[model samples]
Target: MCEDEKSLLEKAKNGDVFAYESLIEGYQKKVFNLALRMVGNREDASELAQEVFIRVYKSLKGFKEQSQFSTWIYKITTNVCLDELRKRKNRNITSLDEEIKLEDSEIKRQIEDDKPTPEMIVEKNELKKVVSDAIKLLSDEHRTVIVMRDIQGFSYEEIARIINCPEGTVKSRLNRARLALKEILKGKAELLSYEFVK
Candidate 1:
C-alpha cells in the first residue's frame, strides 16, 4: 500500500465516514471495472459494487491490518461477484448478454473515442463478442480466476486470498482456464491459439 492509502485506511478504520468515502472515491472505478468485466452486466456490476462497499463498511470494525486494505476490499468484491454469478446459475439466468452491453451513453462515448480507427473499433467489438461468449462458457470458478488474474491484473497470491484458495491452486486453475478459453475461442486468435500459453 502507498503511504497515502495507508493513512486513508487508518482514518477509515477509525469510523471516519468521510475517510471511507474518500477511499471509495479513490478505488471505486477499479472495483466497478473488475466487477463489470467479471460479471458481464452493468446493472449487476453496479449493484455488486454497492454490495461490496456495504460489506466493507459493515465489516470494517473487524478488519485486521495484516494485509493491504486493497487486498481485503478485493476479496470482498470477488466474493460478491462470484456469489452473484452463483445465484444466476441457480436461477438459470444465463444468456443475459444484453445486460452486459454499455447501456450508459457516457461510457460508450468514452469507449468510442478511445478507439482511434474504425478498424480498431470493429476489431474491439468482435474481440469483445468472442471474449464475452467464451467467458459465458467457463465454469464460475474458472471464469473468476481468469477475471482476477488476466483481466484485473491481480497477483496470483492476491487472487488466492480473494478466492480462498492456495496459490498453487490458483495457478493450476488459471492454466486450465487459459487452455479452455483458447480452445473455445480457437480461431479468434490471429497468431496463435492454445499454444499461446506455452
Candidate 2:
C-alpha cells in the first residue's frame, strides 16, 4: 500500500468513517465486478459488495497487513458471494439463465475494439453471452477460479492468497476450471468458434 492508503487504513481502523470510505473508494468497482461475476446478478452483486465493506470495516483491526489490502478485500468479496450462493443453492434458486446486466462502460471494456461492423458487434455480444452462460454452469470452485484468474485478471499468487490455498493448488484448480469451461463451451462451438476452445 502507498503512504496515503496506509494513512487512510490507520484512520479507518481507528473508527474514522470518512477515512474508511476513502480507503474503499478505489476498490468499490473491483469488488462489485467480482461479486457480479460470482453471483451473476447486478442487484445481488451490489448488496454483496456492501456486505464485503461492512465485513472489512468490522475486521479492520485484525488485518495484519500480511497481504496487499486489495487481496484481502477480494478475499472478503469472494467469501461473501460464496456464502450467498450457498444460501441460494439451499433454497433451490438458480440463476443460470438470468441475464447479467453490464453497463455500457463495462461492455466497452469487455470488447475494446474501437471500430467494428454491425455483424462483428452482434457476433461479439453472442459470444459474450455464450461464454458467460458457460461460466455460470461451472461448479462453485471452478467458477471462482475462472472468474478470479481469467475474467478478473488476477495473478496466480494473488488468487492463491485470496482463496487461502497453495500456489500449486491454485494453478491446478485454474487448469481444471479452464478445462471445465472449455467443455461447457463446446456445446456452443458454432457461436464460440475454435479460438475460445483453445
Candidate 3:
C-alpha cells in the first residue's frame, strides 16, 4: 500500500466515515464484480458487497497489514459471497436468465472482437450470458478459483492468500476449474453454436 493509502487506512480505522468511504471507493467496483460473479445476480451481489464493507469497517482496527489491503478486502469478499452461497444452497434458489449488466468498456475488454457492429454486439452479449451461466454451475471451490484468477485477474499467490490455501493448490484448482468450466460449456448448445467450445 502507498503512503497515501496507509494514511487513509489509519484515518478510517480511527472512525472517520469519510475516510473509510474514500478508502473503499477504489475497491467498490471490484468487490461488486466479484460478488456478482459468485452469486450470479445484481441484487444479491449489491447486498453482499455492502456486507463486505461493513465487515471490513468493523474489523478494520484489527487489520495487521500482514497482507496487502486488497488481499484482505478480497478475502472478506470471497468469504461473504461463499457464506451467502451456502445459505442459498439450502434454499435451492438460483436464477440463470437474469441479464448481467456490464459496462461497454468491460464488455469490449472481455470479448476479443473490438468491432462494434450490431451483430458483434449481440453475439458478445449472448456469449457473456452463456459463460456466466456455465460459471454459475461450477462447484463453489471451482467457481471461486475461476472467478478470482480469470475474471478478477488476481495472481495465484493473491488468490491463495484470499482463499487461505497453498499457491500450488490454487494452480491445481484453477486447472480443474477451467476443465470443469469447459465441460459445462460443452453441454450448452448455445455456447457450442457460438464456437466457444471446441
Q: Highest lDDT: which candidate?
A: 3
How do these models rank on TM-score, best leading?
A: 3, 2, 1
Residue 133's lDDT in candidate 1: 55
Clashing pairs in 3: none
Q: What tens-digit string does per-residue lDDT give for candidate 3 at 1-198?
A: 888889999999999999999999999999999999999999999999999999999999999986789999999999999999889766766432232223210111122334343354357676687689778877788889999989999999899999999999998888877876776566554436467534
The candidate 3 region of ten consecutive residues with least summed lDDT is 103-112
| lDDT of every model, 2 decimals | 0.73, 0.80, 0.81
lDDT of 2 by residue, 56-168 (tens): 99999999886789999999999998999889877878633332223210111122224343355358776686677667767778789999988999999999999999999
Question: Where does model 3 exceed 4 Å of error?
Answer: 94-122, 190-198
lDDT of 1 by residue, 1-198 (tens): 667767877888888888889877867988997888778878988999999998998888788877767888888988898889878867877643222222221111111123233244246566676677567666677788888888888899888888888999999889877766765566445423433566
Best by TM-score: 3
Q: What is the lDDT of residue 152 in candidate 2?
A: 93
Local error of candidate 2 at residue 98 (angstroms) = 16
Candidate 1 residue-pair clash tally: 0
| Candidate 1 lDDT (Cα, 0 to 1) | 0.73
RMSD of 2: 8.5
